[model samples]
Target: MKGDYNFFSDKKDDPLDAVCPKLSYQQRLWGFLICSGIGWFLEFCAFISFFQGNGKEFAIIFSIGNLVAIMSTLFLSGPKDQCKKMADKSRLISTIIFFSTLIVTLVLAFATDLTFLTLLMTLVQFCAYVWYVLSFIPFGQRMLKKFFSSCCEFE
Candidate 1:
């Protein structure tokens, strides 16, 4: 060969190649707070309804919260968004919490007559699910970093 030539030669640059900036601290804080608050409120509503002798309403509201939590998580980890990154620790803990809450939810679901307990467990599970999704966000990553740093410093 008179000259070395490669097929993958590209001198042009595309704007689409640029990555989106990570979320700001404020954005993450607001996201975490809003998501957590809405989840908590939804579950609290279900808990109250259960004690009000409105089992039907309780079930409906609880299901709604559960769907919201799961769907939101799916949205966060959605394949379309290639920028989100979750720390290893965050992913591990979230997975553990998710499974643990899932087991408790299932148990409580079958226990019957323990409406209050069931609602409480469901709430916990929803919160865990929310955290799982939040972990992939920049704010969540920062929060986790700070938490681990504090823990290490205390030791």
Candidate 2:
């Protein structure tokens, strides 16, 4: 629709892409906070659905929440730019793992009646999500590896 925010629209034409910015800092901050909050709530509800034996609901809601939460980062960088960053070398592997697991989790939840597989993939998806986040921090993944290795070292 004409009024809807087409987040993927080109920068110069869109006016929200920082090239010729439209949204003010406060508006962007509010948008981020609100979307993140809604995402968190949906994730929480997904947990309830899981325990209530609604596997498909759990998968859909949880995935939606994850997507919404990630989408909130668009407020920090324009949508296309954010997508580029996700596909960049530093974040690529984790992004692939995260998205693939998300798909696997949903498929297992809906296609097969395999609770174990769906749950396992969902857990894996969450871990991949965290890993993807770590990619954004300088040395975060390296530090985590070092920490784990040091903890495992036994003389």
Runs of candidate 2 exceeding 4 Å displacement: 1-21
Q: What are the per-residue Cα lDDT tens digits for candidate 2 across 1-155?
A: 23545344443434435442456667778888998999899999999999998877888789889888888888866665777899998899898999999888888877898877787788888888888888999998899889899999999
Deviation of model 2 at 56, angstroms: 4.0
For each candidate, give its TM-score against the true structure.
0.42, 0.81
Error of 1 at 140 (Å): 1.5
Residue-wise C-alpha lDDT for candidate 1, range 40-130, written one tens digit per residue = 6786898898888875466556656664444343232222222223326547787578657766766666657776777677778767776
RMSD of each: 10.6, 4.9
The candidate scoring highest on lDDT is: 2
Query: TM-score of model 2 relative to the true fold?
Result: 0.81
User: Residue 129 in model 2: shift from native, Å?
Assistant: 0.1
Task: List clashing residue pairs in candidate 2.
Answer: none
Among residues 3 or more apart in sequence or in different chains, the pairs in candidate 1 whose N, CA or C atoms overlap within 3 Å are none
